[model samples]
Target: MFSNLSMGALGLTADLPTAIDLAAKHGFGGVDPDLGYLSGLGGTSAVSEFASSVSEKGLRWGMAGLPINVTAPGTEFAQQLAELPAKLEVLNAAGVTAVGTWVRPMHDELPYRRNWALHASRLSLIAELLADSGIRLGLEYIGPKTFWSTERFPFIHSLGEALELIVEVGAPNIGLILDSYHWYTAGESADDLEGLSDADIVSADINDARDDRERDEQQDLDRRLPGATGVIDLDGFMSALRAAGYDGPVKVEPFMKSLAEQPVDDVLADVSARLAKAIG
Candidate 1:
């Protein structure tokens, strides 16, 4: 498995290549450039340069960030769907093998009660676009504010629902972005991660949670680190991955405010240590 870093760690201070270098130097094998990073590099030319730069650093360029709203209905549906081609083109130009979106099932739909149909439709459309460009699309399961099962944000309550969406979309280029925080926040047990493979897991996010669905702001502060500081079952999750034959990156995507103020070396060291314990 590779050690990966999401550009969200650096916020707005660093540039694309700088992030990649940081990750590589810190022993991360891959880098996921946030959408803002791509936007800053301009268009096609920038994407090509980014791909080249990441490869030069011996890091796999993974596309991270959510830009498409798969839960939209009707006109807004067409709007997000229309944007897929350009997004896929951006990934293609950037040499990004996979595109990850965190808000696919969370927002972007109208009166979205029938979330199943909304998600499946958009996934199919976007999957086709990404397939044309040989880029895989990943659906990241995360919460917007409240945890899953309580609200209709981020992702749904059922792991089966997310899995079914992927199966129904039925594209080899389409897959799941499994996340530890989302798993706990959504109330899914570690046993739920059975039967998956490296191919099914296109991307993954790691963050731990310590509390229940209390207040939105409070939950945000508690979720960070790995399975160590939270109520999450990390050992069981690692066992599940082994059962499913997954060998991929364990991306540190904690949104905790504490890590934001820490120095890059210290922050990376902490995250790297947690990843080592989890993935070792």
Candidate 2:
């Protein structure tokens, strides 16, 4: 997989043009441009220019955040769903091949079965739209036990459950955003990843958990740079991706306050170094 820069995930506030420039400057092969921002640029001419600029910089579009809000109720969800095609059309012109969003692992009202159905129904529709544009959609499962355990109903918190949801959706464009942090928190092994083919993964995230927290107690937002403390098995994780022949974007998503607070260039350089060190 290639190194991709995700500005929001890295806690940077760079706009699309600046992000593209920074990504290339920082040695990232790809950049996750904001879909909403891209949409705002308007029309075919603007999008073509932007795409050309990225290509000229030797960078490609990585997975963007899925613009549709899957959890909004009835009419709201319908409105977002209806507007997706237009947004996707813009993304298509920009040469974006993939988009992804996370699945909330728990629900206060809906139980497992109902929640699963809701997600499947909504995601299936979204996936169909993405499929029409030759784009893939990746669904990320939150794995930290602490995030889901205290809720009234736990939904998908593991790779197995995520696969089940994908199966239910049964859309060819549906895949996974395989993440090192979640894989570790869910107590999954490299063997689990062995079962997946490259196409099964749309994108990936590489990060480390805090050493002080037990696996089950780790918070979702609290993370370290890959290999920072050797608390996560990053080597094994990268090995699995290589073995699976995953050639998609593999981004660093270390949600660390210190890193976020640093200058944009410092954050980019640090992540580039850590990612190279972890995956090399």
Looking at model 2, residue 99 earns an lDDT score of 90
lDDT of candidate 1 at residue 240, scale 0 to 100: 78
Top candidate when judged by TM-score against the true structure: 2
For model 1, how does the per-residue alpha-carbon lDDT over 161-211 read when each residue is reduced to its tens digit? 667778887888877788776676566777788778888888776776655
TM-score of each candidate structure, all chains considered together: 0.82, 0.97
Give me the overall lDDT of model 1.
0.68
The C-alpha lDDT values of all candidates are: 0.68, 0.89
**Sequence-dependent TM-score of model 1:** 0.82
**True-vs-predicted CA distance for residue 69, candidate 1, Å:** 2.0
Clashing residue pairs, candidate 2?
Answer: none
